[model samples]
Target chain A: MTLVDTLQTSFKAVLSYRLRSLLIILAMALGVAAVVMLTALGDGARNYVINQFSSIGTNLLVVLPGRAETSGSFLGAVLGQTPRDLTLKDAQLIGRLPQVRRYAPLNVGEAELSAANRLRAVTVLGSNANLIPIRHMKLAQGSFMAQGAGSNAQIVLGAKIAKEFFPRTQAVGQRIRLGDSRFLVSGVLMSQGETMGFNTDEIVIIPIDYAQTMFNTTSLFRILIEAKSHSEIEPAKQAVLAAMKQSHDGEEDITVITQDAILSTFDRILQALTMAVAGIAAISLIVAGILVMNVMLVAVSQRTAEIGLLKAIGATSADIRRLFFAEAVLLSMAGAILGFLLGQCGSLMLRLAFPQLPAWPPAWATITGIMVALTTGVLASILPASKAAKLDAVNALGKK
Target chain B: MIRLTAITRTFHMGEQAVYALNDINLQIASGEYVSIMGPSGSGKSTLLNILGLLDKPDSGCYELDEKRVTDLSETEQAQIRREKIGFVFQSFHLVPRLTAAENIELPLTLSGIPSEQRQIRVNEALQAFELKQRAQHRPAELSGGQRQRVAIARATIMQPSVILADEPTGNLDHQIGAEVMTLLENLHHRGTTLIVVTHDRELGARAHRQIGMRDGKILTDHTDDAG
Candidate 1:
C-alpha cells in the first residue's frame, strides 16, 4: 500500500479506540513535560547563581580563617582544641601587595542598636574606610567614616537600620548605642540588597578598631579584597594565600577564594544537579515508553482479525510493521508537541509567580524534550510492531 | 488449470495427528465452475485453502498452470495468490475501516498497481456490482447483500484467473445467496476458473461439476453437462 493509505488507515484505526489512544498520548506528554520542567529548573537555578555572582563584580575575592592544622585527629579539632585566629596583621600584609587595589578586614557580631525609644537586634560589621572601595558602597546621606575613624568610635548605618533607628530624624550625626559603647552615625548607606544569603542593607557598620574594642575581640573574622584590574584578581588571590601561609607558620589556616574558583565550583554543582534531574526525567520517559508498548501490544491483540484480513489481501509483514510503527511515531510526536506546549505554559506560570526568577526552558532543554519523546515512542513500539509483523496470517484469520 | 496429486494435509490435535485432507487428486480446468460439497470436518475448506495457497498440504504435487506450486516458498505462494487468484470468504471479510471503493481496490493496491489504474478498476467493479451508490459506505454501514457484493467486487477486481469462494453465500438469505452465486458463476462464464466450497447441496448442484467429499477424501466427482 502507498504510504498515505497506510497512514490514513493507521490513524483511523487508532482513532477508533479513542480513549486508549488518548491515555497513551497523555502518558507520553506527561513524561515530556517532566523532562522539560526539570531541565528548566536546573537551568534557571544556574542562571540565578551566575547572575548573583556577576552582580557583585567578578574582580573580587574573599579571605576567611580556616581551621588550624594540628598533629592530631579531626575529633580533637572538632572539640575546640584548635587555635582560631585570623589577625589584622595578615590583612594589612595582604593589602600591601602590589596587585591588590584595596582590602577591608571585617569582624561580624550580633548586637542591639538603640536610639531614642527604638531598639533592634542587628548584625554589626566592623571594617575600615577601605570597605567603601572594596564593596562599591554608595551613600544615601552624609559620607562614609574617614580613615582616622578606624581608631575613634564612629558608625555607618545601613539603609534599613537607619530607617528603623531614626525614622523621622536624620541618621547622620546621631549617637547610637551598640552593646555598651556609643558611636556617632556618620552616614546612611544606599540599599545594597542581599548577597550570598546575607542582607547587606540590614547591618550596621563600624570601624574595625571600635568593633574589636566593643566586642572584646582581637582577631579578624573575614577579609574582602579588590583587584587593581580584572586580570589581577587571580594574582592577588595567590599573593594573599602565599602571605597567609608564611604568616601562619606554613599551615593552610586561611582560605583565599577568587571569583573564577567560586564560579567553577558553582558550575560543577549545577552540572551535577542538572544531570540528576535529567536522569530522573529519563526514568519517567521510559515508563511512558513502556506504557506505549503495552498499549500497542493490546492493540495488536485486539486487531488480530484485521491484521489477518490485511495479510490475506496481500500485505507483507513489512507493511504491517510500518503501519504500526507509523501509528506509534504519530502518537509520540503528537504527545511531544502537546507536552512542549504544556511545559511552556508551566514555565510561564512559574515566571508569573516569581517574576524575579531567571528565564527557564533553555533552547537545548526544549529540543532534548522532543528527542526524548520521539525516542521513547519509537523504542516502546518496537516489540509490538515486531509481534504484529510476525503474526501468522492463517492463525490470525482463524481467530474470532 | 489447477492440478493436485497425492495431496495430504494433516493437523496435530494434542498428541494425535488428524488428516484434514488425505491424498486428494483433482484437476480443474480454466473457465470451469465447480463446487465441493461436504459436512463439517470433511476437508472441503482445507482443500479450498490449499488451492488458494493460503495453506500448504503436508504431502502434495500441486500444479497451477504447469507451475509446481506445492514446492514454492510461502512468499512465492503469496505472490502467486496476489497475482493469479482471488478469494471470497463465507463471512465476507471486508475491512471495516475502509470504504467499499477502497476495499475493492485493496488487491490492486497491494500489488502496487498505479493509483490511476486502481481507481479505474475499482470504479468498474463498483459499477458491475451495482454498488456505486454505496461505494463510500464502510463495511459496518453496508447491508449483508451489499457487503457480499463488495466482497465479490474486491475478489474479482484483480482480474485473477481463479476465484475461490468458501461458502460465499452462507451468511446471506436465499435471494442474496442466489445473487452472490450468480455473480460467482458470471465470473466463470467470463473465462475465469471458479471453485466454490459449500455444505448446501442446492448450491453445490448449481455448478456444472460437483465433488462430494467425506472423511478427508473425495468420495465422488460428478459432472452435470447434460443439465
Candidate 2:
C-alpha cells in the first residue's frame, strides 16, 4: 500500500479505540513534559549564577589563607589550623606587584553601633580606599576614605545603615560609637542590592588597621585583587602566591583562585544536573513505550479476524507489519508535539513567576525528548506487529 | 481453469493424526459454476481453503490458469490471490470501523490503486450491488443483506477471475440468503468462475456441477448441463 493509505488506515484504527489511545498518548506526553520542565529549571539555575558573578568586576582573584590542594582534602586549611596567617604585610607586598591594578584587604566582623540613643547590631567590613574601585561601589554623599589614611577613625556607612542611623541629619561627618570606639562617617553609599548572597547595603565599612585593632587580630580575612588586564590575571595570581610564600617563611599555605575558575565549576555542576534530570524523565518515556506495546498486543489479539480478512484479500505479511508500525509512530508523534507545546507553556509560567530566572528549555533536550519517544514507541511495537503478520489466516477466520 | 491432484492435509489433535483432506482430486473449467455439499467434519470447507491458497496441503499438485501454483512462495501466492481470486465468507467479515464504500474499496486500496481510480471502482461496485444509498453506513448500521452485499462487492472489486464462497448466506434469513445467492450467481453469469461450499442441498442444486464429500473424501461428482 502507499504511504498515505497506510497512515490513513492506521489513523482510523487509532481513532476507533478512543480511550485506549488517549491513555497511551497522555503517558507519552507526561514523559516529554517532565524532561522539558526539569531541564529548564537546571539551566535557569546555571544562568542565575553566571549573571550574579558577571555583576562583579572581571579579571578578579581571591587569596584565602591556607592551602586547599586539588586532591580534595582540606588538610590544615578551612578550620584555621595553618601555621601562618595572611597578614597586612603580605597584602602590601602583593599590591605592589607590577601586574596588579588594585587590591582590597578585607576583614569581616560584627559589632553594635549606637547613635542618638538608637542602638543596633550590624555587620562591619574592614577594607582600604581602593575597595571602592575593586568592588564597583558608589557613593551618594560625601567621599570615600582618603588614600593612605589607614589610622584615621573614618567609616563609610552602607545606604540602609545610613538611613537607619541618621534619619533626620546628614550621615557623613556624623560621630557614632562602634564597639567602644568613636568614628566619623566619611560617606553614605549608594543603594546597591545583594551580590553573591551578601547584601552590601547592610554593612558598615572602616579602615583595615582600626578594624584589626577593634576586633583585636593581626590576621587578614582575605584579599580581593584586580589584575591590570585580562591577560595579566594568571601572572598576578602567581606573583601574589610567590610573595605570600616568601613572607610566610618559605611555606605555600595560601589558596589563590580566579573568578573564571569558580564560575566554570558552577557551570559544569549545573549542566550535569540538567542531564541527570533529563535521564530520569526519559525513564517515563520507556514506561510509556511498554504501555504502547501492551495495548498493541491486546489489539492484535482482538483483531485476529480482521487480520485474517486482510490476508484473504491479498495483503502480504509485510503490509500487515507496516500498518501496525504506522499506527505506533503516529501516536508517538502526536504525543511528542503536544508535550512540547505543553512544556513551553510550563516554562513560560515559570518565567512569569520568577522573572529573574531565564527558564527556557535548551534545543538539545527538546530534540532528544521527541526522538527518544519515537524510537521507544517503534521498538515496543515490533513484537506485536510481527505476531499479527504471522497469524494463520484459516485458523484466525474461525470455523464456518 | 483450476486443477488439483493427490492433495492431502493432515491435522494432529493431541498426537492422533486425522485427515482434514485426504488425497483429493478435482478440476473446474473457467467460468464454471460449481458447488461442494457435505455434512460437518466432511472436509468440504478444508477443500475450499486449499483451493483459495489460505492453507498449504501436505502434498499436492495444483494449477491455476495453466500455471503450477502448489509450491509458490507466500508473497507470490498473495499476488496471485489479489489478481486472480476472490473470497466471500459466511459471517460477512467487513471491517466494522470502515464505511460501506471504504469496505468495498478495500481490495483496490490494498493493491496500491490511486485514490481517483479506487473511488471510481468503489462507486461502480456500490452501484452494481444496489448499495448506493448505504455507501456511508458502517457495518453495525447496515442490515444483514446490506452487509453481505458490501462483502461481496469488496470480494469482486479487484475483478478476479475466480470467486470462492464458503456458506456466504449462513448468517442471514431465507429472504436475505436468497438475495445474496442471486448476487453471486449474477457474477458467475458474467463469465467469472464460482465455487460454493455449503450443506444446503437446495442451494447446492442450483450449481451447474455438484460434488458431495464425506470423511475428507469425495463421494460423488455430477454435472448437469441443463441446470
True contacts kept of each: 0.33, 0.73
Clash pairs, candidate 2, are none
TM-scores vs. true structure, each candidate: 0.86, 0.91
Best prediction by DockQ = 2
lDDT score at residue B89, model 1, on the 0-100 scale: 88
Per-residue C-alpha lDDT of model 1 across residues A285-383, encoded as one tens digit per residue: 788888889999998998898787777766778878988998998888888888888888887887788776764887877888789889989988989
Candidate 1 runs further than 4 Å off: A42-59, A66-87, A98-101, A110-121, A128-156, A165-192, A207-218, A227-236, A248-252, A258-270, A356-359, A362-372, B113-121
DockQ of 2: 0.78
Residue-level lDDT for B53 in candidate 1: 79
Cα lDDT, model 2, residue B167: 96
Q: Pick the candidate with the highest TM-score.
A: 2
